[model samples]
Target: MLDKQVCRNIKMVLLDVDGVMTDGSIFINKDGEFCKSFNVKDGLAIELLRSHNILVGVISGKASAALDTRCKHLGFDEIITGCKNKLPALVDICSKYNISPSQIAFLGDDVLDIPIFEKVGLGIAPVDAHCLAIANSDWVSTLKGGEGMVREFVDLLLINKLDLPLKDIYKPLLDKIRYDDVAIMEQ
Candidate 1:
């Protein structure tokens, strides 16, 4: 269980892109075009979270121009690409933002992200994350990657801190993203 004060202190949510944001798959075309599928509901959740003043960012190991385009469209606080040593980059972000690890939440899905999870105050892992990753996480998401996992985490965080009912606060955004076809589970 997350402490109320800890959750309240979280001002930023940093996510790993390849496995945590997408399904850990990349499709490159003959012309070197990169392709990825982002969950619309997750995008809406991010918009809502940012509206409440919680910053969101992506730190990706492999560089992709597609991710840069997506980050620009979503208005992410920061997007760090080609970061093989993610922890050092994370340190830079924390320092630049003037926020401590206790004020940040990190969501990751693989072994490389373990060091990050260990350092951040709140470590979240999706259902599809590796077993070792899950073992290190403080909270394990019920949803799979590229399937509204981020949205689910956002909803939980907001509902705990905000007074609004979950559906009332989030349904409109969910509807806009066609979440009816998506299956959200609690694990």
Candidate 2:
């Protein structure tokens, strides 16, 4: 069973970009343009959750045009970057969304994210997250960042919040293949 408190209180999901979204890799070109790799599964999960009326946002300490472009493409409800003090940003997000601190869920993987984590209802940390962050989280994913960690969190939320049938969501994709096809695909 999911936490009843979490299911009841969560109204918004906020994320930190570097560690939470991209495994904390800052790929800088010689020209100083930075890029990051995001997991496709995580992106799809966000789309599905947003479609179900849950608002999502990102609050990152570092600003990047790549992040802006990605968030725009993904249709994130809000994106507040270059946030040195995350608590104020959280406060602003809560005020703008007409939500309370208890109605927010935040995902983070570093020390800088702890303030926001402490203020939100559902604080999430990835498997390989900083030790302090993991200790602070209400929940921790089994997967690491830039893997399927976010998707795992999304699955839990879907199961509890929407009571969505897990089988119904993925059965078609699974049923399309034979056992031999699965073996072949694994190869």
Candidate 3:
């Protein structure tokens, strides 16, 4: 069980892009384009989180237009790409928000993400995450990445946690995406 106080105190959510969001697959097309899959439910959950005033963003070790495209579509507060080291980014985010590690939740799936787990208020992992990731996580989702795992995490923390009106559910603002480029999940 998550400490309700911690959940209540959560002001931001940070997610790792590759394994945690897309099942760790990278496909390159013949046209020299990169491809990755994103869960729409995960996107919706991120929208829901943002609606409730919880800032959400992505930090990736690798860079791709796919990440840039998806994060932009989702209206992320911050998007930091090409990060070989994520802890410094984490610190910058915390500093930008004037918040402590205790007010943030981080999701990751590999050894590279260990530093974030060590410092975040809540460390969560997908079901298929690396053993080291699971060990350091404060919570683990039952679902795999790109398979509603992010939704599972959101539900745990904010399903019925908000006082959202039915109207908000009917027409979520996050559904609006201004896609100047081709915006679709890659597989």
Candidate 4:
């Protein structure tokens, strides 16, 4: 269960990359390039959050081109990588956004994320997250990372915090398609 007050206070969402977004898997090709998989549903969820005026950002200890491409595609408000210590990154995000710590919700999945859990208004962990991370989190998702967990969390925020109905959450997106003459299928 999520604390409605805490959820309502969230103005920004921060995410960890490896575990929270990519199932904690890192694929290195022969050329020393890294590859990662992201859930399309999570992407849609992020788009919805952004549409509703909630800022989103990413923080990771590792840096890779794949991560950069994904963040760019999502149009994240902040992207901080190669950060071994995420506390400073949090501070930077707060300062940059001019949002208080109590207005931030972070979803992370490792021991490294515990310190952040303590500071943020809402700390969320995926079902497969580290035990300590789960213990510290304000809420735990039913799904694992890279498996629509982000979508699940977003739905909760939309419905419980923002008072948007689940079915109506797609109105903004659907309206665009309906009004823009975008073809969904070719005859």
Candidate 5:
């Protein structure tokens, strides 16, 4: 369960890649270029969050061209990579977005993310996350990373923020899709 007050205060959601977004796997091709697998459901969850005006961003200690491309495609509000010390990035995000730490929710899966958990309004961890990380998190998703955990979190946020039943939370997205499809057909 999440604190309704905390969920209501969240204006931005930050994510840690690798463990949180990609199952912590790094695949190198024959050319030694990195490849990553992302969940389509998570992608849609991002779109849903954006439609409701909740900002999303990514912060990772590792840097990769694959991540860069994905962030671009998802239209993240902020992208910070290759930073081992994430607290400064958190401070910077707060300053840049003009929102306090209590207005942010972060999803992370390793020890590197524990500091962030202490600062943010809500800290979420995947079920398969490091034991310490799970222990420190405010909430733990039933699913593992890269397996719709983000979607699950997004559902919870929408449910709480909109004060709607779970079934109704997706109505706005469904309506948007209908509107878009109809507009396209007319064109």
Candidate 6:
């Protein structure tokens, strides 16, 4: 967990889609189309972050319809895709927001994302991420990517940053999970 002062300094959270958002897998269907699955837990976490008025954005090195669809559905504040050089995009975002890199937090899970760690205030990686990513991250998530990783991360942020009660912040996410599980069981 980040210290209270450091967490309070964060204003935005940027995510890399392939590994940070998903399991770093891109499946091509028989029709030669790509597809990806997202965890509801991650989605809810993003929603919670948004509800707090914290900006949420996705920056992907590759462009995909799936990425566009997911970002649109999730109402991301910013979406940058098809940019291999992430530093420029990060700079652009900082320029647009009139904020310094130190005000941003980046979640990434690959070697390419290493540069961001050096730039952002807080750099985080999913548990099952690349070794380099883990090595470079300021914090490594206990949960695997696409397996409620964002949820846990957000919970930490809510608790540490705004001083929100963890029990209160966690209730909404946990309740949704329970409801979804029941729906699955009823199926």
lDDT for 58 in candidate 3 is: 90
What does candidate 4's lDDT look like per residue over 1-187, in tens digits?
8888888889998999888887988999999999999989999888888878999999888899999999999999999999989999999889988999899999999999999999999999999999999999999999999999999999998787867788797788777667666565542
Report lDDT (Cα) of residue 101, candidate 3.
86
Q: Which stretches of candidate 6 lie over 4 Å from their true place?
A: 170-187
Please give the CA lDDT of all the candidate structures: 0.84, 0.83, 0.85, 0.90, 0.93, 0.87
When superposed on Cα atoms, how far off is each prediction in RMSD? 7.2, 6.3, 6.1, 2.2, 1.0, 4.9
In candidate 1, list every pair of residues with a backbone clash.
none
User: Distance (Å) between predicted and true CA of 98, model 6?
Assistant: 1.2
Candidate 6 to truth, TM: 0.88
Q: Per-candidate TM vs. native?
A: 0.86, 0.86, 0.86, 0.94, 0.97, 0.88
Best-fitting candidate, measured by TM-score?
A: 5
Model 6 has an lDDT value of: 0.87
Most accurate candidate by lDDT: 5
- Estimate the TM-score for candidate 3: 0.86
How far residue 69's Cα lies from its native spot in candidate 2, in Å, is 1.0
Error of 1 at 127 (Å): 0.4
Off by over 4 Å in 1: 167-187
lDDT of 4: 0.90
Best-first order by lDDT:
5, 4, 6, 3, 1, 2
User: Where is model 2 more than 4 Å wrong at Cα?
Assistant: 167-187
lDDT of 6 by residue, 20-40 (tens): 788878999898788988888
User: lDDT by residue for model 5 over 42-124, one digit each (tens)?
Assistant: 99999889988999999999999999999999999999999899999999999988999999999999999999999999999
TM-score of 5: 0.97
Q: Candidate 5, 82: how far from true, in Å? A: 1.1
